[model samples]
Target chain A: MSVKQQELEKSWQQYKTQQRKKNLYYAFLTVLSVVVFLAIWEAVVRFQLVNVRHLPAPTVIFQTFIEKLHSTVPDGNTLGQNVIASLQVSLTGFFFAVLIGVPLGLLMGWFEPFDSFVRPLFELLRPVPPIAWIPVVVVFLGIGLKAKATIIFLTVFVSCVINSYAGIKLTSRTHINLMKTFGAGTWETFFKVGVPSAMPMVFTGLRVSIGSAWSTLVAAEMLAAKAGLGYMLQVGRGVGDARIVVLAMVTIAALGATLSALLNTLEAHTLKWKEMR
Target chain B: MENIAEKNIDTRPIKVEVKNLTKSFGDLLVLDNLNFNIRQNEFVCVVGPTGCGKTTFLNCLTRILEPTSGDLLINGESADPKKHNLSFVFQEPSIFPWATVEKNIACGLEVKRVPKDEIERRVDRILDLMGLRDVRKAYPKDLSVSTAQRVIIGRSFAMQPDLLLMDEPYGQMDIKMRYYLEDEVIRLWKELGSTVVFITHNIEEAVYLAERVLILSNKPAGIKEEVIIDLPHPRDITDPKFIEYRNYITDQIKWW
Candidate 1:
């Protein structure tokens, strides 16, 4: 290559390297912040700055976590069992919500008659909290995993519907016009222009729906789940064992964060064409 | 309803006919008995006094609005998007950001369900002609606005529609880019052999790009005059005859 061409290639390599380094630095900073925060908590506990009875050290929580992984102990189920129970219930409800809500939302937004028919009912129920439906679910599903899952489904379904609906509403008129001029049928226009245009918002709804799943998971499990993190929390509270309570909290937080991270990865892949974050 | 792609190709002497087209918004008359005809395989530009119901006329032609009276006919059939192969390039770039340069150009073809091999062939040819081959796989977000506009124009042309309507597509571009785009359009029109109706406010642009210019009168509008440009291929903008035609059209526009 000519010298100028070589220079450009060299600069491009440098730019990539610089970008990689920047990302690594940000990651390192995040790790450092969490580590520093954990150290302070450990110090406070060790020095008796806080009541040990009320709050446990990170080491104690970690030991309890390890023990709970293998032993059911007071909660009558192991950590793995509780996690599995929680995942099954939450994911069932969450997936059902997405399946029913997303298409419902898309159709409602696109078809005027559908929107007219569904809007009144949707708006009427939107304000009532999902937890308020726990009694209704219990009456129907009898407080088993089914009842718990139904509660989560309710919590998640609204956001999925609302976001995807708004996303479709945000579909560009220019695009629809373009499709019409191209002699596209209504269905063709909806799939090609309306659906793709609504995706970013749909994904936004998905993220919101996933979050609602976790937030409602605990409450749903509290409605008499035999094995779940939320059940463990209630049992720990009943027996005045703050350690198990904190353990359940930590596990839930960690699992929720992991799911959120996975969702973020999916969003990045799907919306690669979106300009800027 | 017939699918445009599957429709047996039918050619009529006049590709488009506007017969006493009238449009009124409640009581305000926007278009008043507009009448015109665009011949098959012809390039026609429509110029009018600003806000002379030009957009209403276009909207009527595209069936975006129901005209108060009269009708537009394409190939001896009532104008319907599903019944005829038609393409439109809007005043602004309307490229789909989700699609790549190649997919964006192939959108019209895909809509009409053209054969996959045929779609690919036409897309590649247009991508080369439009100088979009290098960025064929790149999405619209990564491209410049002008590049995005090229994708739009390329898409409209790639369909090789029976009728192509463009509404001031270069309105937002600089004069230099506008001229470049205008030349590309003229070349595409010549090669694709589609009847084109371009709407522009610029008299010079109408003169430069059109074989026939239909100048419209002030609001409550109708065609004022028809100026058929009798110039050689690749006509010089700086040529004396070209300037004379431009001046004459400009005067006609002012009078209207």
Candidate 2:
């Protein structure tokens, strides 16, 4: 029986290896397809199928990205500086939203009084887009870092609050009962069982909120701003610098994808125990 | 019926007493004016039809559910779980999935704040007893159903409670594993001299493990009969007395 068990384990390992290889093959094809699409865009631009003034080739955008890296503007800022600026503002807003949203969501999920009283207010405010709040924010705070941060914060806050509450609500009923049987008091059960169980869902909310907060950067930057990737894109559009605009768009996509991947890793690490289940 | 038995048993040193224990949820009554007496170190098996309040009796004993109107006494006083060493092994596997077999077995000790060295000693002994030494570090999800059930049993037995409550704990196991675990429970109970309240729908199981068997009626459950088994430890399943009692209880349960 032991020998048979070893053989079965070996065969399972081999099966997993084959599955991984197949997945990698598919992933390679996906990358190849993306490359092919980019090549077509380059071919169209090189052959002057579309005016260079309107749409730059991949090579033009790549050069623009490199040039912006080396060239500092009047305020001692380069393209990298602009990217960092946008990230700082956006992340600041996102963090504030997380700080406020998580507790509010927990209260809404765990307590009937808060759910009844505060949830309605949140629902009423949630439907209004974050960008729509920009006019009022600008009127109060003006076009500065604070105004941009406020917009991003509001954008992420609604989604985070909704997701966090959902996460808490989705906690397993069995877990709570088990704790109760163990003689755990109400507060102890909430901390030991409810919070840990809801963590995965809360992380999901954070992921969605982070994505939305990043998305609002470009919109926030479209308004009056001195230095940010969004401001750079705005400047490029003003001067008809299609190469710079393309570079900004590519940077935004890359940043969004990278941040999302990082959050996925964090979620996986925090939920390692769930993997066994 | 249990109430009749309750009246017959002298109450001088009763460990637990149930008086007019009636329970109802909404319009449905599950337990009706039930009464029973459990002495210290006695092993009692409650056999009943589905939804016949066997589980409800155990719940009331543990104070998990409030009795609609009843008095539950432990040691001639009101039963308070916090003050008593009482533990329950649920019908399904209730081993904490978050903890390994060893850690799960040690949970009550940890909750009760037993010394570290003592916990380690007792955990090792229980793991050995359950034949789970090899899977000490294995989580519940990684173990087979039989192995997981052992973890639950081992955990409760580790607590060495004054009264151990088991609710159809071996219902999910195969025959061999079930008998083995039942014997293991008997061994532990004998060693600790703890009172036990075991609930099962299986008539054979009640006869095999219980000192006294209490049969309950179907929905709107009332105790139907009680029988005392005088057989010695490691009872012969085919013994004439065993077969006689088994048949009599089977008839009572089936007809009622």
Give model 1's docking category: medium
Regions more than 4 Å wrong, model 2: A1-52, A72-76, B1-13, B115-118, B191-193, B236-240
DockQ of candidate 1, scored on C-alphas against the true complex (2 decimals): 0.66
> What is the iRMS for every candidate structure?
1.0, 2.5
> What DockQ does each listed candidate score?
0.66, 0.31
Question: Which lDDT tens digits does candidate 1 get at residues A1-277?
Answer: 6999999999999999999999999999999998999899999999999999889999999999999989988889999999999999999999999999999999999999989999999999989999999888889889887899889888889999998899999988888888987778788989999899889999999888888799888889878779999999999999999899999999999999889899989989988989874
lDDT digits (tens) for residues B1-256 of candidate 1? 1242134343448888989899999999999998888889889999988888777788788876789999999988889877688888888668999999999998889888899999999999999999988899999989988888888999999988878889889999999999989999999999889899999999888989888889898987888888878775577899998898899888888943
Per-residue error for B239 in candidate 2, Å, reads: 4.2
Q: After superposition, how far is residue B131 of candidate 2 from its true place, in Å?
A: 3.5
Candidate 2 lDDT over A91-132, as tens digits, reads 889989999988888778988887999978888999999899
Clashing pairs in 1: none
